[model samples]
Target: MFRTVQDFIEDYRDESQNTLKLLNLLTDESLKSANTPGFRSLGHLAWHLVHDDAGMLRRIGLDFKAPPAGAEPPESAAAIAAAYRETAESMLEAASRWSDEKLLESHNMFGRNWQNGLTLLMFVKHEVHHRGQLTVLMRQAGLQTAGVYGPTKEEWEKMGMTAPK
Candidate 1:
């Protein structure tokens, strides 16, 4: 968990860039791909990441507002990337208004009080988890996967490098 607001902001900036790269690899057709019918599509997953960050901020008594209710998921990869960037910017801006003490203060989330730092960390982890899933789904749907933490499998092959040890 983050202890200082600066730590959260820096980490968020890095993670958000990675997310944007991943989104860039999506295709319009791939947005509808999912493991099964009724499961969340790639577009849905991306949209959720955008809204959920704002929701977590709200749960911590912040003024962050989620995307509009029933907003249709964007099919275009460009749109998804743009939305993620916008949300990340808003999150950082909101965080900038808080002090380190405020970040460490307790806030209620899901009926339990947690330090705001912890809640924010949880939100970041949650986004990463879903994003990892989306990357695999993207491959299965025949879309290219962009390098996030490091080079993706296909990327490594293209560079004449085997998977990292």
Candidate 2:
């Protein structure tokens, strides 16, 4: 869990950039990719990251520019990437004002009382979870994925090393 607002900020800065890199790789048509028919599509998962970030922050009394909960994602992959970038900036700006003490305060989140720190932690964890899903969808759509923690299989080959099987 985040103990200081700065911790969350620093982590978010890195993670959000990683997300942006992957988002930029998405093609307009690839957004339709999913694990199976009738499942959530790549577009829906990406847009959820955008909307949920702002919605969760707003619920905690930090309002920012983001799509409304029910808003449909644009067909353009660039638009979704732009929205994610913009909303992430807004969230960083809004969160910058929070003090460590404020992070320790309890607030009702999803019907349970939680520290603001936990909420911030959830922000990163939730995004990471969906990001993993998006990567699978990206692969299914035949798109190359950006590396998050380390080089991908192709990236390893680019480095002239065998990728672990």
Candidate 3:
């Protein structure tokens, strides 16, 4: 969990950028990619990350510009990516107003009382989880996925390094 607002902001900035990188790579056709029938599509996962952040942040009195919860994913990939970018900036702005003490305070989240800091942590983790799912769908859609932590296999190959098996 974050102990200071700056710590979370710094991490959130990097993570949100990584998400944007992946989002930008998506094509309208790729958005329909999914592992199986009736499963969540790549577009749905991406939009969920965008909208759900608003709901979670609002719980801690942090409001960002985002689509309402349960909003349908847009058909245009560019629109989805643009919305994510906008919300990321908006969220950072709201979080910047918080002091470290505010982070430590308790907030009602998902039927449980949670430290605001923990909620921030969980929100990032939730995004990361769906991001992993997106990479798989991107691959299925014949797109080269970007690396969030390090280089992706395609990136490594471009760098003249053999990717791990």
Model 3, span 1-165: residue lDDT tens: 999999999999999999999999999988887879888888888888787645777878887778888788999999999999998899999899889999988988888999999999999999998889888889888999999899999999999999998
C-alpha RMSD values across all candidates: 1.9, 1.4, 1.4
Better of 1 and 2 by lDDT: 2
Winner of 1 and 2 under TM-score: 2
- Native-to-model Cα distance after best TM-score fit, residue 80 in candidate 1, in Å: 1.6
Give candidate 1 regions above 4 Å deviation. Answer: none
Candidate 2 achieves a global lDDT of 0.87
Query: Backbone clash tally for model 1?
Result: 0
Model 2 lDDT per residue over 1-165, tens place: 799889999999999999999999999998887778788899988888787744556667666677788899899999999999998999888889888888888778888998888888988999999999989889988999988999999899999999998
State candidate 1's TM-score. 0.90
Weakest ten-residue segment in model 2 by summed lDDT: 53-62
